[model samples]
Target: MELLIKGGTVVTASGSFEADVAVDGGKIAAIGKNLPVTANQVVDASGRLVLPGALDAHTHMAMPFGGTVSADSYLSGTRAAVCGGVTTIFDYPVQHKGETILGLVNSKKEILERDACCDYAFHCCITDLNGGEILDEMAQAVEEGITSFKCFLVYKKEGMMVDDGTLTRLLLRARELGALINVHAENPDLIDLRTEMYLKEGKTSAWYHYMSRPEFVEAEADKRVVHWASHLETPVYLVHMADKEGLEACIRAKEEGHTVYVETCPQYLEFTCDVYKRPDGRNFVCSPPMKGKESQDALWTALKSGFIDTVATDHCPFQSYEKDWGKDDFTKIPNGCAGVENLYPYMLDAANSGKISFERVVEVCATNVAKIFGCDNKGAIAVGKDADIVIYDKDKDFTISVKNMHSDYDHTIWEGKKLHGYPVQTYLRGKLVYDNGNFVGKPGMGQYVKRSHK
Candidate 1:
């Protein structure tokens, strides 16, 4: 079926312009003042904005963490994603200890095949670097459409973390293979030593969790990794960066002509360490914990100046009872929070308040993410692209509540926050999957996207 979105401003990386977009056969057929094409359905977008649907590049569904799995499965997670105007998500395929990358990818593929309400992709996590199996499987995984890989520097004791030497090798190999290397940058040694001291002092509170893993630890690790990536001439992406020093390192690397990119989450932008000091701080606990107000301000500055490339949720969720597990020991709690349904509204609020331009919001939320993940035809409101689009009512105002959320989880960190913008309709491949607070599309309507390495 053909669909026409009339009288809306189309925002993209190039600029925003008032135009009409026509979709036929699941791709954008035309865009201009008068498309001169008939359609089976017409949407009156006169007072709204039309932009590329958000592409969330970081999320976890039914992920195993801290001896328990996340509460939301793929079906629930992607449902929530679509409700927030996101048409696609890129989740991680975590490699278990001693497991081959191929095995991990296949397992995740099976999980997604049964679930997932929206389009999705995967990033292979490198857990064991000692074996040459990773180097061997890299090309096969990339050929099968997984072009990026992630490695951690903080889970050293569990074998999930890779040391500087292993990271250097992986980055060099990825560069040679024409792929991107993503790093979870935080110095485990520094955090462990500080955590031990706090536990000895009987001060194992959530606030201390943030204090122990301070910005310096993240900044130092980021500087080291960016330097290594520069040396190897590899494209590097820093995930969940929380401080100004880390942003400064990325900016410096970029100034030196390296292909370095950084991403920050809403938790860092919306919450502060004070949330940890609350009696119920476990709700806000996450690795690279939320920073002080100063760091938050610096992150906003980085966003405005274009130092930050994207805003991802890192949407890892746990129930409140699970949060209770950390009441006695902070380390026992899962290190994540839920926000797949809040990404668009929060950023829209920021834009409405004059903190960011509408075009910049579209770039960070959609276009840039697609470019980084190698989704060539999925990011813009242009002719010959996939018709994954969003129609947002910019003047709508409402309070965020778990009552209105679509995820299986029971709580929201942003619950009760008021926002001025919301997605009224979302289309993936020119099919109306979500419209006005209801999901009208069927499962399996979304197809897996094979990213190009070009």
Candidate 2:
């Protein structure tokens, strides 16, 4: 089938231009003006902005955390992702203690096979670092298309958290195997100590949650990780930077010639500790919790200055009732908030408000994510690239409501916020999945994309 998206401003990394994009057999066949071609389907994108579909490289679906699973399953999460104009998501696969990386990959594949509704890829979480077998398995997992591994520095007792020695070894192994190492850089001991002190003082409010995990903890750990990666000559992607200090560390590392990448989520950009003190504080609980307004301003500046490379949702949804599992104790609350369905809209609103350029929005939300995750054929509206496109209506304005959401979760962190821009249509692999607020494609149409060895 051939589809032509006619008369739209096609946004790309290089520039934006009014062009007609022709799609055939799941790839962009041509992009030009007045193309001499016929198509089975023609999408009149007049007056709208046609850009590459957003790629959310960090997401957790049906993930087990805090003794409860995330509310959004693969089907629900991907459905919401497509509805929000995200074409591809690189989800994390948690490797259990004592399990091989290959085994974890296979298990995640089995889980994804049952429910995913959009294109997907995997990033292996290195939980067990002491086992030498994981080193070889990391190489093989890379060969199997899992090109990135995530290791946490805060969950130290759990297999996912690694000490400095373990982190160094993992970085060396990943560098030698041609893979990227993603770090969840937070000082666990500091956080734990603060938590204990807060509990002893009988102060268990949501605000103290942020108070317990201060910026200096993250900044210290981030600075240390950047130095270690530099020493090992490994590329490090700093995940979910919460504030200015962490962003500065990333900038310093980049200035020092280290291949450091920084990713910030919408929560960091839009919300702050203010949300934690709201009557609905539970909805705002996440690791490296939202910071002060000053931090938010610094993050915005970082985004504009190119110090931040990408804006991922870090979409992890939990039911409101489940938040009580923490039971007035902030430590027990599951760490994550829901936003897979709002990433593009929030960023688009920012663009419309003159906070950033539309080209920069595409770069951070689509191009850079795909490049870092090794999805070479994605993240661009050009000839020979995958036909993953989104037509956004800048004239549209809508307030976010739970009633309009496609995710299984009943609430949104951005509820009631008015958004200026929205996706009018979302196409994946040359097929219309979401059109004008309705899902037009069926399940199983989305392929599991194997990333390139970039």
Estimate the TM-score of every prediction. Answer: 0.98, 0.98
lDDT value for candidate 2? 0.87
Clashing pairs in 1: none
- lDDT by residue (tens digit), candidate 1, 257-332: 9999999998899988889989989888988899888889999999998989999999999988888898988877
Model 1 lDDT, full chain set: 0.87
**Residue runs of model 2 more than 4 Å from their true location after superposition:** 157-159
Per-residue lDDT tens digits of candidate 2, residues 61-83? Answer: 88998889999988889999999
Off by over 4 Å in 1: none
Per-model CA lDDT versus the true structure: 0.87, 0.87
